[model samples]
Target: MTKPTLPNTTSSSNQKLPSTAHSPVFRLRDMFKPSFDLWVISWILGLVTALSMITLLMVSGWFITGAALAGMIAVGSHSFNYMLPAGIIRMLAMARTAGRYGELMVSHNAVFDLLKTLRLRFFNRLAALPLVQQRNTLHASQYMHRLVSDIDKLDEFILRVISPWLIASVSLLLLAGFIGWALPLSATSKTIIYLLLLSALLLPLMASLKGIQSAKRLSQVSESRRQKLLAPLAIITQLLLWQQWQAQTKSYIAQDDRLQALEWSAQKLRSSYMLLIQWFFYAAVLVVLFSIYQLTDSSTSLTTGVDVPLVLAVTLGLLGIQEIVVPLGQHYLALGNSISAKDRLNALLQPSVSEAQANSTIPTDTETGLALPTGPLHANLTHVSAKIPGALVGAKEVSVRIDSGTPLIIKGPSGCGKSTLLQALAGELPVQSGEVKLNEQDWFAYNWQDQLGYLGQQLDIFDQTLAANLRLGKPQATEAELLSALDKVGLLTWLQAQPQGLQTPLGEYGAAISGGQARRVALARLLLKPRRVLLLDEPFAGLDNETRERVWDSVREHQKQGLLVVVSHHEWDMGQCDVLTLKENVFID
Candidate 1:
């Protein structure tokens, strides 16, 4: 039977890519993915912040101008109490300060919470992907960039994106209601209010559209720089010994230069948008001033005594609205970054086949189901082949079978398929042909993931304490269990020498320790949770010979309980263990 294929083109020159389950319109609710209550408080605080500032500025202006006029007139001091306005001014000032601080605190907490959610989801997705899918540097870097940086940029979703538009919308409505009540019903009042309304909405909409392409490009280049910069940092010694550091440094400098150019382009566009908005504000100010002049040029009007203060209030209110509306202009980049990051992430992290086929069940019918054996864990591979989704080469027509009490060592030349075979056995890949089974059942059918332990060549060290990192493998492991595992991996002496021992922070990516120590720490983590089957890929790559022997001795002790599969270029002494040699798509024992 032929497998499925997505249409590569449609009726247009510019083709639409097939949409995946991961694609969705970015929502403000996602900003509160971790803590809804905190997000709600953040939004309320933001509203309070804007309302307080508007009230403080307009009320202060009115009170100051009105007091001056009252003092100048003969009936001045006794006409009204001066203390009320003065006290209100002081109260508004205090409210504004407190609201601003609360807004920052709540919103920042919301942002940090959102970031934690994103990082956890990202790592989980990567963990779920097949090794073949993971080997694509393009895909991996994009995932990493999103995991480390794009999620941080998304904090703008709060301050710039949602909060600005919401506050602006609410302010406009309140201003319109207040002006309609306060001003005389005239052509001038109608014109000022309508123009103010249009300008308030139109200016931001235009600004959001203007620099979008620049914003999009900057986001892309920023991701590229992150991928390039971190890759070399992870393998600085190898690159330096290969004598490629100078070229890498020069290329990184070029990336930085390109970044500067992109930022300058975005800056130019943002500046133009800002200056244009300021002009619209100036026009609104002139209209308000003209309206005030028409109202108060003479002293016999109905609102005569209050006219100066009213004028001050109206003019200052308009200015405050302009200030509140400015943040919306800077929100373009947030949208751009979100779109880019989501697209890249969705492409790499499609849901697993088991998840998609959740309702499908295994049957004991003779036509299809094979009866599983008892007493030992069994894995059988028959002419199985697996490949990276878009790559040119992979394993083909390889066959193998192993059960408990067998240690399998896969030996092959470079570009052979040992790693891919291990991934297939680990349930990380589906065979394009033939079959793989555990105990006579499809490996994915019976919760086999819990029964398997896999340690790949990649060294993943979280920013956590030593014990905390080790505890990830088996969260409920006791202190004695941890110490036993560390001793098995030869990290006990090293752990004791640390100032804080198990409490010591590993820093970012385990930068606090040496390469061999990091590897052993990872191995210790693996040892903390023993599984029915253990697959170790290059577990001894950076270890000394004695440490490697000790590691093998520790693992060999577990051969009775289950199977062991190791992939390595270096030869080791094997006592009755099976060896599979893969060459040009053939497996030989």
Candidate 2:
């Protein structure tokens, strides 16, 4: 076994500490404030785009009417000019096209920025989780689903909630003011404006509230499908051979069908909202026609030429509101889902009650300070009891002392607490009673995570290059350092046989490599950066005898400087090492 020099194992990727805001909505609000400049650009583009669209429609109407009138004047041998109307029409067309492009680009950019910040916060919480917490997920908790899907839902608040709500409100205000200016003395125009705005408000509100139950169901079923069905892809063949795949697949498909049904129902509600908006739109046009009639009759000062253009522009502007308003009818359910997603993610990301209160002031003698342990690293568990996560009983009354430069091998029968004992030593499982200390102090006193390296029973390999995966242990590790670690694990020859070598991409879950190779690769990652105490669970399970001896020799080199606690079922001659055997009789009935 050979050991090479290693860089410091300091982890600098700790996430930004969470704020003290109580509400998830408020937390999301605080996150969004930093991107205020991007949002402002998006808002301005949205406003400009909506107004240009309204102008486009209104001007088109005016030009068509004016062209007809001019043709009549030409037939009557009277002079008429077409240049001004033609020029305005061309200009409005260009502005409308450009404005639409700018709005899509800027609004999507802001939405992307918001989502990027939010996902970073959420992922940091995942990265900072303790090994014990990661091992406790065999029960039905769809964390990945929430991290990806639920976090993605939050962007709806940007596109569906913020943009539509604010943009439509601004367009309504501007349209009302423009109409009021066109007919300052017309009472009928004021009434039309009031009704148009009322319909805009009511339609969105009703559609939104009506679909809340359906949206909640959608989120719940999607998560269930992810946890119960999609997660079992690894064992799909075993399930098929057992003849249970049909029932399992049918159950998952049932959820898909239910989701589709709810979506169809939501579409019906949106259609209803659209019908209502159209009815109110026609009513507003009728009111404009009536206002023009009153203007011509009461003033006798306004002619057909003046009253006609005013009526067309005001009516078309009201109609153009549907451009900004009708789409919101489809968004209410998504908005509700986004609110729910925000709450779920916030709850998951918050520190535990104990850690949350750790920030409060305490006595000077208190053991909460962050400092490296200077003396020999020793792990002692005194009469400590521990339970398997989500279970009532596990290892009981376990006591042991692990000192630096001494390797401990845990051997046991099938039902023994060997694995749980390793977990307690590594601080992966909570001690139900008594204490587990390092260097005569609580483990928390010694720069908590920096003192322990735990590789649990399972192998975790990401779909990245061999070099990138190795760097998870020490992000600044060099290419030569990675090759050296691989050689120590008996994989250097195998790596050189491949063209890409360290740069080769591993398929998802390391499927492109054999199972033994995956385990060795993970082991190589652990060996790259040694810690004060190492807890490995069955590291030799899949490796051949030769590779096992080589790997054990590699681990022994590090044991000369730190404590080694390994959990394995098969017996081996581990000379000069303290061996502890645990039986299930103590904790089981």
Candidate 3:
């Protein structure tokens, strides 16, 4: 079988391209704003703790230097005290360990709080965006990956990336200050060394930016291919009779080889970059050692022969600076990947063109709490067409109307735009060249959500209790009201037969129930949501004859209360209902 091809339009091409800047960073910053106070407190505490640890390391070096000097004096027949140095080292170590633990606790809490905020913001943004817009931008799996994987990258940014650099930087600055005040090494020399180390750290990052972008793109492609391969392979048992195992294996191997090549190329580039960084690191260490040696030799009279304590401190500090650069480089690389992922997610969460505005007025009926005007509804379409990408053109010049509380049966072959017409009526589909009106008012003029209840051909069920799914239509509905709706839909007996009754979990997409039962559950939900108009797309397609009759009966019973528009190829025995046949042209009576 041939693989499906996506559209070759400009919009399709544009979607294939990735954004230059990661747009989600700005959004993430906004999300973290609420936790700023806790973040600030945590950062301050972390800095203090880091300083304490650094001080302890420095004091331990001093103790070592003191013990060596005392031994030297003892060999020269002189006495020197080592008790003070030992006591101070022990005290500093204890304090440093305690401070480290405290900092960890505070930082963990702060980062977790920020992560929660990010998750909420991401979900809220998705909620605000229109469904069609989201579908156009990202696949459901990609969105899930971003929500799980990309959000996790922030943890690396905080813990493995930012905190260590911060601590190292502050410690270096404090050491430089103390050395300039207490030793003969001029502040100018220290400043030069610091600049050289900074250059070594930054040069690799600048050189690797383009490479990082390339790697990220390649990784995304690789991931997409992997998902494509796995999704079908997962259902292989179902297709085993038809699909050849050898052919499938060969195809997967070919795709895997292509992705592996790209991955290897990226890895090679990264390795080269790291090699350069390693060389730079060695050069920087040599430069630091030479500078210290020159300073000590030149100021022999200005300070006692290069105190071992200070020399050891300088060596350890330089090593810490070197350690800092590696994390910084890795941080930048990780950030590039995260930014790319975030940008994709941000595009998905952008508002749709058909997004409803706040303060939009909705027509309402006082008695039924349904959104329909007092007059009759006349829907019109003149040269209207819905051109969806990768799908058939929905409908053209499809003009139809139903007077108050009339049942209209839309008859057409599959993919003949029957559902599209109903969707247009519900305001889900955009009218390209014509208008749709409810109660003679422009559909856009009134909020349509409260006015219409739609059930698509494919029924979707959540992994929740059966009662929870029904309650989605009416959250405040009591058990008695729910039982009544179930009874009306002829599902009450089935519900009672379940081991847990209404409290039974439906599993993902109602996987625990049969197709007919899932349809009934959806029907129950629709019944609970009182609406002025109902748009059902083959709601009875998968039901048995008896269940189908019951559902049809339920629709006929509800017709007197509101308008019912149904799209189905199956024959119905309803009386006094007008049938609208949609062939090349819509025929309505």
Question: Which candidate has the highest lDDT of all?
Answer: 2
Residue 226, candidate 2: C-alpha displacement in angstroms:
4.6
TM-score, candidate number 1? 0.73
lDDT of each: 0.69, 0.70, 0.62
Instruction: Provide the lowest-lDDT 10-residue window in model 1.
Output: 1-10
List ranges where model 3 is wrong by over 4 Å: 1-28, 45-54, 75-81, 134-140, 143-148, 154-161, 186-192, 204-220, 227-305, 351-371, 376-384, 584-589
Q: Write the per-residue lDDT of candidate 1 for residues 1-589, one digit (tens) a residue.
A: 0001111111222333224334543444566667888877877877787888888888888888777777777453588678898898889888888988998898777777788887787666655443334444335656655656665666665667677888788887787677666766467666776686778678778667655566678877876776678877888999899998877777677888899998887777667666667677667767766665676646564355436676678778877887877666655566666655665555446544432232123121222323334478878878878655554567888889887887888888866878877766664454556776677766544444345677766667889999998988888999999999999988888878888988999988889888778877887887876567788887787787888888888877854678788898877675778888888543332
TM agreement with the true structure for every prediction: 0.73, 0.81, 0.79
Q: Give per-residue CA lDDT, model 2, range 1-589, as digits (tens).
A: 1111111112123533335424343244654675788777777887777877887787777767666766755676446556776787788777778777887887777778877877787676554444344444323357665767777887777778787788888888877777777764467568765777777778887767766666777778777665567745668998888987877688778877877887787788778787777777778777777766655655543444355655677778788778788778767687678767877777665445443332222112334355546667777878767767556446677778888888888887765677777666555555556676767766544544445677776667899999988888778998889998898888999999999988989888899898888877887888887677778888888787777887888888966788898887655665578887776644442
Q: How many residue pairs clash in each candidate?
A: 0, 0, 0
lDDT of 3 by residue, 457-524 (tens): 66669999999989887789899989988987788998889899889999999999887788778878
How does candidate 2 score on lDDT? 0.70
Residue pairs clashing, model 1: none
Report the CA-based lDDT of candidate 3 relative to the real structure.
0.62
The 10 consecutive residues of candidate 2 with the worst lDDT sum are 1-10
